[model samples]
Target: MKETKKKVVNIQEYKEKRKQKEVDRNELIALIKQIATLK
Candidate 1:
């Protein structure tokens, strides 16, 4: 039972990390687009 709880916590952490990474990637893309347009 303890192991299952730990696994659930790990999964939550992994999901949060993935979400943050996606947001960062999107922001980077937007910045790139703006720079491209400026040039």
Candidate 2:
């Protein structure tokens, strides 16, 4: 039972990390679009 709880916590952490990465990637894309428009 303890192992299951630990696994759930780990999954939540992994999901949060992935969410942060997606946010970073979106910002990077937005910057690229702005630069492209300038060119």
Candidate 3:
């Protein structure tokens, strides 16, 4: 039971990290598009 709880916590953390990563990637993509338009 303790192991399962730990796994759940880990999964939640991984998901949060993935979410942040996607946000960062989207911001990067937007910046690139803006720069391209400026050129």
Candidate 4:
């Protein structure tokens, strides 16, 4: 039971990291678009 709980916690942390990376990618895309428009 304790091992399963640790696995669940690891999965949750991995999901959170993935979500943060996606957000960063979206922001980078937006910045690129803004710079393109400026040119």
Candidate 5:
């Protein structure tokens, strides 16, 4: 039972990390677009 709970927690953490990474990637893309427009 304890192992199962740990697995669930790990999965949730992984999902959160993935989501944050996606957001960071999107923000980076937007910044690049702004820089391009300025040029």
Candidate 6:
């Protein structure tokens, strides 16, 4: 049971990290688009 709990925690942490990375990726893309439009 303890092992299962640890696995769940690890999965949740991984999911959070993945979501944060996606958000960062999207923000970078938006910034790039804005700069391109200004030119």
Q: In model 1, where do residues sit more than 4 Å from their true spots?
A: none
Model 2 lDDT per residue over 1-39, tens place? 999999999999999999999999999999999999999
Q: Which tens-of-lDDT digit does each residue in 1-39 have in candidate 6?
A: 999999999999999999999999999999999999999
Q: What is the lDDT of candidate 6?
A: 1.00
> Which pairs clash (backbone N, Cα, C closer than 3 Å) in model 1?
none
**Best-fitting candidate, scored by TM-score:** 5
Query: Which residue window of length 10 is worst by lDDT in model 4?
Result: 1-10
Per-residue lDDT of candidate 1, residues 1-39 (tens digit) = 999999999999999999999999999999999999999
Q: How do all the candidates rank in terms of TM-score, highest first?
A: 5, 1, 6, 4, 3, 2
RMSD of each: 0.6, 0.8, 0.7, 0.6, 0.3, 0.6
TM-score of each: 0.92, 0.84, 0.88, 0.90, 0.97, 0.91
Each candidate: how many clashes?
A: 0, 0, 0, 0, 0, 0
Candidate 1 lDDT (Cα, whole model)?
Answer: 1.00
Compared with the true structure, all predictions reach lDDT values of 1.00, 1.00, 1.00, 1.00, 1.00, 1.00
TM-score attained by model 2: 0.84
Instruction: Estimate candidate 4's RMSD in Å.
Output: 0.6
lDDT over C-alpha atoms for residue 20 of model 6:
100
Over the full model, what C-alpha lDDT does candidate 2 score relative to the true structure? 1.00
Model 5 regions more than 4 Å off = none
Q: How many backbone clashes does candidate 4 have?
A: 0
Error of 1 at 19 (Å): 0.4
Q: Give model 3 RMSD, 1 decimal.
A: 0.7
